[model samples]
Target: MVHHTMATSTTRASKASSKINPMNLRLLRFLSTALIVGTLVACSTTPLPPASPPPASSTPPAVGAVPGDTAPLPPPLAQAKSRWVPVRWAELPGFSTDALHEAWNAWVKGCERPAPAFAPLCGEVRRLSIASPEEQRAWMVSRMQPYRIESLDGNAEGLLTGYYEPLMDAARVPGNGFNVPLYRTPAGLGERKPWYTRQQIDTLPEAQAALQGRAIAWLRDPVDALVLHIQGSGRLRVTEPDGSQRLVRVAFAGTNDHPYQSVGRWLLDQGLVRDATWPGIKAWIAANPQRVNELLWSNPRYVFFREEPLDGLDAAFGPRGAQGVALTPGRSIAVDRQSIPYGTPVWLASAGPTAQLGRLVMAQDTGSAIVGAVRADYFTGWGPEAGDVAGRLKQGLRLWALWPRQP
Candidate 1:
C-alpha cells in the first residue's frame, strides 16, 4: 500500500528543541458557544459549490485513450484544493509557494508540531518577497476550510455544533456537554439551549421527560452540569485524617453538577474568588447578548469548567472532605477511564490551537478513546471552551508511558 505525506510551511519566531501540538482555544470557545448559541456555517459546510460546467469527458495523454477522447473524473482534493476550500468567515485559503521556505511556513500554521526546522515562512517571505499584505490576505483565504460545510445562520450554528458530539460517539453521555454553557439572550430569542446531568438521565424524572427516550438529549438552559465518565477499579491514593495514604478505587467516569461560570479563575489561571465575589464575569456574559459569541469566542480557555482545588471548589464542587483534596487520583485520563491506567504518565501530542496554552503537560485523567492508543484530548480545563475544543479535534499521535526502563 502506498502512503501519502503532507508538507507544511511555517515561520519560526523562536526556535525550540521540541515541537508543540495545540488547538485554537478561541475557536473551541466558539464551538462551545456554537452548541448553546446556534449552528455556525463555514464554507466547509456550505453546499458544494455549483458543479464546474461539466468538463468534456476526455482521456489523459498517459492513458491509452487520446486527450479529450475519454471520460473525466473529479480531480483529487489536492488538485482542486483551492476551489473547494471555503472563503466564508475564518475558513479561507492561504497563498502557496513553490519555494521550500513558504511551503515550510504554511505547514507550521496548519497543525501543532514539534520544532527543529528552520522557519518556513521566513524563507518564503525573504525568497519570494510575497509577504505583502495583499499576498498574505490571498494566502489566508486558501487555508482549507476546517470542517465540512456548516450552516452560518445563527439558528443553524447551534444545530450543527450541537450534533458534532453525537455524530462522533453515541455512548457520549451528556453533562452540560460544553464545559462553559452559552449564556445567550433571555430564552425564546433563538433556539432552545441544550442541557445534561452527572448521573444517568433515567434516574431523574425530569431527564426522562426531557430526553423523551432518546439516548441523548438537549438542554433548554445550555448552562447545565457535566458529569465526567468514570471507569475501571483503581483505588484513589489519598492520605486520611490519620496521616496515612489510602487507596480508593474510583469510577472510570464520575458525575458532577458544576457550572460554566463557576470555574473561571482557575481555568483562566486566575486566583480563587472568595465570598459572593459578585456574579462578575458570568453576569457580564448573560447581559451581553448582541455579540456575546464573538466576545467569548476570543479567549478559548474562558469557557472551561474547573475541577476543585484550583477553583476553591471540592471534588464534587464544594468542600469534598478528605477524599477530594487528598484524592490520589488513580492515575487515569478523563476521556477513556478504563483504558488508560490511572497512574501511568502519558505524553499527549495534540493537533489544535489549545495545545499552545499548555505544552506537553501531564495527562492525569482518562477517557475511552484515550486508552493505550496514540491519541489524547487535553482537559481543555473544563467548561464550554473545554467542551468545544475537546470535540473539534481529531489527530494522529505519538504516545509514551512513564515506567521503569528495561534493565
Candidate 2:
C-alpha cells in the first residue's frame, strides 16, 4: 500500500524528401509560381473573385499539407495542473548516464494507447527497442525536448511515495485457515452511489446478502486481504477444491465510494504507534489481536476486485494501469493526470533513505492519494521485496517531462 498520496529519433521526413520525383518537382515549381502571383495580387485592397478549386491530387500528403511545405507543430500548452518550463538536456540529472535501453520496453507498451500528440513517434520508439544505450540516448536528445515540471506557483520540489502489487496464498473455497473473503463487485453495486461502507459490509446483513456468492477467493489472513484492497491489485496462489493449484491476479474493479482514511494516520492520531509502516502495523497487530476489527473499521472505504488468469506474457507484467497497458516493473509510475498526461516519458530523480533513483519512467496510472503537480507513486512491481520498498518510500522528488521535439 502507498504510504502517501502523492523517445524517438527521426529523419523520416528528410528521408521522404530525398525521394521526391521529377514530376513532383515540376508540380511544386508551378505551384510556387502561382503562389508568387497570388501574393502580389493580394496587395490590392479590392477583394478578388474566388477561383475554382484545383483538382485534388490522387496521392494526398501524409500530413495535412504538402509534406515539405508544412512547418512543425509547436509543443502543446502547459497543463492546468502544472507549469512546465523548457530546459536544456544538460539540466537533467544523470542525462549522460541513465540507461535509455532499460526504459524502451515501457515506451513500447505505452504505444498501444498513446496520446494523440505522441502517436506519431511510436514507430521510431519500437524500432529502437534493441538499440544500444548510447544510440537510444542520442535519439532521445535529438527527438525530444526536456521540460522542468513544476507547480503552478513554480515549486519544483514535491513528494514521492511507492506502491506495489501484493502476493498471497488463497483458497478457491473457504476452509482450513483461509476464511477472509476477497470479493467481486456485488450485485446492485451501482444502484447506490456509495454501495456500502467497509464497516457496513462487515456487520450489516443486507450488505452481506448483496455480496453473497461473490467471493472470488479466500485468503488466510485478513490483513493480507486488506493489503490487496489497499494496493488495488494482487497475485494469488490458489488451492482449488480438487486439490489443484493455479496462480491468478485480482485487479481493482470498483470501490465503495467512501473517502479513504489512512489507517496509519488513524494509529498515529490515537497515540497507539510511532511507526506506521506495514511491519510496524503487523507488529502492533501481533500484540493487540483483539483490536484488529477496530483497526480495520477505522477506514470506511472498501475495494472490490475481478479475477484474471495469470498466463503467458501476462504473468510477466503487473495489472493494466490507468493507461490501459500492462505496467513495466520499476518503469511505470502513477501520477496526477492533471500534472502530466498519460503515456508521457518522464525523468525521475529522487534520493532518500529508502532509495536513490535517477532514471526514465512513464506516467501510466493515477490514484486518489496521488494528488499534486509534482507528486508521484513509483510502481515497485510485486512480492515481498517490492512491498518492503513500497511500504517505506516517502521522500523528496523532482521530475522532468521528455516530450517530442517539433518537426
Candidate 3:
C-alpha cells in the first residue's frame, strides 16, 4: 500500500549517528534585551536581496564554526535558497506560551554538531537545559534574532508534511506468514546505476539469486515492506531462530538508484481511487486482490537497509536525521537546506486536519520532496500513532529562522 509522507517518496539512504556534547556551567549571562532590540532595529532597516539558488548537488554543507575570538559577531548572511528579513520577537505567534524547555532538548541535541553560527552558544544552551520556560524564552530573546523566511518572490506560506519511523514485527528467518524479505544492499549494487526495478526484484531469478542469504529479517506483509521502504527507517521486533526476541533498527543503507515515484500520486492520476492515503490504498487492494502486483509495481524505486541494534538510550530517540543527530520526536524537522541549513533552529507554525503546530524545531533533516522556502517535514516520532499522523498530515506552513544575535 502507498503511504503518504514527505519521506515516503523522497527519503534517500542515510546512516544514523548520535552525540551530545558535555556541559559547562560557567558561561556568561544573557545579553541585554534592550541591546538586542536596538540591533534588530538596525538590521531591519532594509530586507536583504534575494540570494542565488542553492546548489543542485546532494552533498550537504560542511560543519563549521565561528572563530573563538573576542570580536563582535558578524552580520548574518542570506541562505543559498532563501532571504532573511529580521523581525521582532512579538512577530512570532504563540512564542510566549510555548514550553521552550521542550525545544531545549532538541537544541542540546543539535549542539552535538553546532553550526558555525550556533557554535558559540552551545555552552549556554547546555546549561539552560534544566532552566524554566521563562528563562529559556528570555535567553532566546536576548541572544537570538528571528528572521521571517521567504522565497525569492517574498512568499511566506508553503507546505507542511509529516514523517515518522515505522515500527513492525519481523522474523529472524522466514516462517508461518513471514515470507516477505527485507534484504541488505546486494552485491555489485554500484555496478548498475539504476538497479533492478521492484517487479524485477520480485520476479527475476538472477535478481533473487543475488539477494539470497542477504535477508536480515522477514516480514509478514508485503505492504509493510513497502511501508518500511517508503519511510526509509524502522524499528523491528525480531523473534530469532533461538526463540529470543530483540528490538532493532533498520536504517537506510542504499537504494536501487531509481527515482522515487509516488504510488499515491499514481493512484490518484489513474482515477483508481478517490483517497490515496495508505488506508484507502489498502482498501482498494483488499477488494481487488488480483491487482496487488499492479499497484505495487506502479513505482519502480526500491530501498535497501542495514540493521542496527536498539539499546536502552537508543530507544528514546528517532533515527538520526541528515544532521547526524537522533531526532527529537516533536522537535525535529526535515527542511530544504537551500532555505534552512541543517542544525538551525526554526520556528514552525501550522494548523490543519492532522495537527496544529506552533513551536520550535531543529532543521535536522532534509527530503527530496521537501523543497521550497517555508516548507518543512515534521518528524512525528515512531510507532502506530506517529504513523497515523505522518500518513495524514499535509497543511500550510510558515517559518522563522531563529538565528544567533551579536553579543
Candidate 4:
C-alpha cells in the first residue's frame, strides 16, 4: 500500500522541468550588484561643492556625516591649551625691584592664609616712612578718599582690599588732606560724607607728625601702583585642561547678609578713634580742618577705582541685590553643586590643573543660577575692584567638590 514516485528530468513533466528560468536568476544577480554599490557609497569621502557667499555669516561648526557630534571644535575664548609657566621677575621683559616687592607683598599676604606648601613667586609690599608729621597726616587723609585711583594691577568688575599707600594721582602731590562724596544709601542721594576734619585731626600732634613723615618717604619712592582685585559675585570663565572651556560663577566676600564696610571701621584700624562713632567722627573731622592728619589716622582701608560703572559692589550685592554668589577659594572641586552643598571643599582639576591637583578646599558659597551636575561658582575676595574682575570670568568647568568631613 506504500508507493513512492520520484520525478526525473525525463519523466512525464521532464520538458517543463528542463526549462531554464533565466528571469529569476537575472533578478538575483541584479540585487547583489545593488547592495555592493550602496556599501561603496557609504564609504565615500568626496568633497562638497562650495556655497555662494552669504550676506553675513558667523563661523559654523565642523560639518561631516555624523550628527550631534560637537567634537573637534576650536576654543572660542582663549587658545586651545594655554601654557602658564612660572615667570621669574628678572626673566620678564620689564621686571623691576619695585615690581618684585609688590609681588612679594601679595605672596606674603597669601601665605598668611592656608596656602600651598610651595608658594607663588611674588613678594611683600613695604610701606614708605614719612619724616614729617604734617606730611604724614595729609597723606593719610587723601589715602582715605573712597574712590580715587586707577588700578593697573587688576581686571574690570573686580574689588580691591588690603594694605598699601598709593598716590591719588589727580592734581597736586597729596599734602595732608583729601575728600570724596559718600552718597546716602536707601535714604538719600548726592549726600557726601566728609571723612577728615582739620581741627580735630590736629589734636594728635605726635601721631600726626609721625604719619606725615611716613607719607613723605612714601611719596619720594615710586611704588604707587594700585591693586585691582576680583570680588566673587558674578560669571567667571576659565580654561580646561583638555583644551575645552568652562564658566565658573563666583560670589562675594564676608559672611553673607553683612552690612557694607564703613570708612569709620577703617579709622579704628588706623588707631584714629578710641571708640567708633562714625557720624560723630565724620562731623569732628569737618569741624577740625587743620587737624586733618589725626582724622586721617582714624581712616580704614585704601580707596580704588576704574573710570567706568557705578561702584559694582552696590549694583551687584547691596542688601538683597546680588552681583554674584559668595565662596571660599578653590573649594568647589567639581562643576555640579546640587550633590556638593554650599561650604563644601572642591578641587577644580579637570578644568584647570594646579600645583595642588587634588588639594582640598572649602565651599563657603552658592549661586542662584549655578544649576546642572557640572557647574561651579568660585568666590573671589573683597572690595569693588575685585567684583569687576569676577563679572568678566566665564568658562566651561569640570570640577570636584570636597566634603567637609573628608577635608
Better of 1 and 2 by lDDT: 2
**Runs in model 1 lying further than 4 Å from the true structure:** 1-340, 352-359, 369-372
Model 4 regions more than 4 Å off: 1-337, 352-358, 382-392, 404-407
- Looking at candidate 4, the ten consecutive residues that score lowest on lDDT are 4-13
Pairs that clash in candidate 2: 5-369, 6-370, 6-371
TM-score of each: 0.25, 0.81, 0.81, 0.21
lDDT of 4 at 299: 27
TM-score of 4: 0.21
Q: What lDDT does each candidate get?
A: 0.24, 0.73, 0.73, 0.24
lDDT score, candidate 4, position 265: 48
Q: Of the pair 1 and 3, which is ahead by TM-score? A: 3
Candidate 3 per-residue C-alpha lDDT over 118-227 given as tens digits, one digit per residue, 9 for 90 to 100: 99999999887777666677778778877889898887888878788888889999988999999999999999888999999999999999999999999998888888
lDDT of 1 by residue, 256-318 (tens): 222322223332333222321113334544665563443332222111111112211112111
RMSD of each: 21.8, 19.8, 13.1, 35.0
Could you tell me which 10 consecutive residues in candidate 3 have the lowest summed lDDT? 40-49
Candidate 2 lDDT over 119-208, as tens digits, reads: 999999978776666667777877887788999988888877777777788899998988999999998888898878888999999998
Each model's total of backbone clashes: 88, 3, 1, 93
